[model samples]
Target: MPRRSYDHYCAASRALDVIGDRWSLLVVRELLSGPRRYSDLFADLPGISTDVLATRLKDLERDGILTRHRIGPRATSAYELTVDGAALRPVLDALSAWGTPALGERRPTDAVRAHWLALPLGRAIGEQIDKGTVTVRIGETVFHVVVDGAEITHQDGPAPGPAIDLVLDLATANAVANGTLALADAGPDAQWSS
Candidate 1:
């Protein structure tokens, strides 16, 4: 490949030099979710075409952004991140946070809220919460579940008092609260809970 020249001020241009195309960053997003097979990338990123996905994968491999693994024939294989590729998590998170507000003021930053809000809801919840208060715990973070009309959410910084309505597990909680998964799906009996 031949090298081209551009001005130093174009940070976007420099960034693009490494991850310029739409497919590249999307591919990185997919990889960030963990190791995934070709079909997995396809299943999650339905917008990409097969030929285009293939080309992007090869280019990433050539550039050392990722490395491919093989597993017999059924599904080709999966892609795992190299150090350089994995380094973009914060960038992805920041980018997500940046775009979420575009949905407007009343609307929340879907990603962050889900994560922070779900910080308290988890699988260990006893068969029935003995107290009326909603409970939430995400690592060291915590919140009490709150309900407003038909919608449920949370409030926090301290232990919740009685009369709240919703509680959740941080990771699984976010998956449920954010629309990635459903209440039925978050059930202790759900496949993910196991």
Candidate 2:
């Protein structure tokens, strides 16, 4: 089947023509952290069907947003963002900021993943510190974010070396993501380990 397009000459429309499909941008979001195996993407995306995921991967590759390469000792095929795809960071940031307000409360039916909070929380931390690694523990979910000047990168699990470790509950983490409470103002209860 041919990919759909708005057939408009505008830049936004042209850009959307490549990334407007369902699950397309989400795939980009998953790859933003780093390379991921097919199984990893499938597992992280709670509701995506296998067929849909495969097609989106192909589409993104065709659009030059991502590339598939062999990685690790086993040479497992992994998908990673290209330079062009990495350029989508600001786009995702804008969307995350705009959508934060709509995240008023967590619905019981809404699936939650700790790493999903990385982008927003990382951005919040970026505001305070110019550079450093921060390991955030939300309940049992552990993820570490590296802030380098204006760039932020995160991965699941704790930081390998010394870092400013922060332990926060879901509510406080949510408030930080929502911009209602700054990480600096997280009160004394928010544990810190250096």
Candidate 3:
């Protein structure tokens, strides 16, 4: 199916024409970390139908938001954001900040993924540090936030080298993300490792 557009001359409208779909930005969100296989994207995005996901990926690729490439010994296909697409980092950050307060509590119906908090939490941590790696552990899930100058990035798993280790529960993580709590206030309870 062809994309539906606002067809207006406005810049916002044109942008919307490209990324206005439901899963478009979310797909961008997942790709922000790094390249991911189709199955990886599907796994992280809970409710998206396979067909819808495929459509969004195709649209994004066509629009140059992301590109598909094959890698590894088996030549598995993966999708990654282009420079233009990565420019949406600030946009996603702003949206996450705006929406933080609305995330009061996790509802029973709400689906929670540990890695889903990576972006917002990384931003929270970014504000405190000049440059460092902070490994975060929330229950069984583990990930690291890397702060480089003004830019912050996170990976899905543990840090490779020595870094600060933050051991906290999901509640505290949400508090930090929503601005209710500061990283410094997380306290001596958190261990710092070499």
Candidate 4:
């Protein structure tokens, strides 16, 4: 094998090249929610035309960022993140943080983003549930936490009961977590709105 050069084989450099295009990472973002059909991906991405969606999906597949699989006995197909693809969570998180101020605020949907980072909220909440049952959703990730008298039992999936739904843009979420921005008021800069 030829020796890897910093410029040629740098992991970070190669990753940027693959995800440099705006849509590529967005596709990955959708996939983090789990397997999505081609149609669903297109639907989530409002403005991407069919041709563009097809091209981007194929491009991501080619780069091993995604894996396309046939689902159901009827052979419907869906796309999901590969092991390599899952590694992009940090990148996506970063993108979410960076893009929040510019791209997140204008959405008309009432979906609230509860942002938590100061504590292992998953664990903290797990310790607080009465008789051990509650529900929480953080982005695409969901889980059930069992409260065993101040002990935490962590499990994945939507928990049951009223969750303290905290919503914030990715940037706000990051700021709250990193202590750079307060959770009390995190929104897009007014200029981004107009």
In order of appearance, the predictions have TM-scores of 0.51, 0.88, 0.88, 0.55
Whole-structure CA lDDT of model 4:
0.58
By lDDT, the best candidate is: 2
In candidate 4, what are the lDDT values of residues 1-194, reduced to their tens digit? 23223466777777677766658887876676468898878877867788878877877788889999999888988998898987886566565445445533335653333322313333334433445554444456454445567444434455455544443444544454444454334455201110
lDDT of 3 by residue, 33-151 (tens): 78899999999899999999999999999999999999999999999999989998888878887898898867888877777788888987888788999999988889888999888
Runs off by more than 4 Å, candidate 4 = 1-11, 103-194
Instruction: Please report, in order, the local distance difference test score of every candidate based on alpha carbons.
Output: 0.56, 0.89, 0.86, 0.58
Off by over 4 Å in 3: 187-189
How many residue pairs clash in all the candidates, one count each?
A: 9, 0, 0, 8
> What shift in Å separates residue 9 of candidate 4 from its native position after superposition?
7.2
lDDT of residue 69 for candidate 2? 96
Better of 1 and 2 by TM-score: 2
Clashing pairs in 1: 119-137, 119-138, 120-136, 120-137, 120-168, 121-168, 121-169, 122-168, 122-169
Candidate 3, clashing residue pairs? none
- TM-score of predicted structure 3: 0.88
Cα error of candidate 3 at position 165, Å? 2.4
| Candidate 2 segments exceeding 4 Å error | 72-75, 187-189
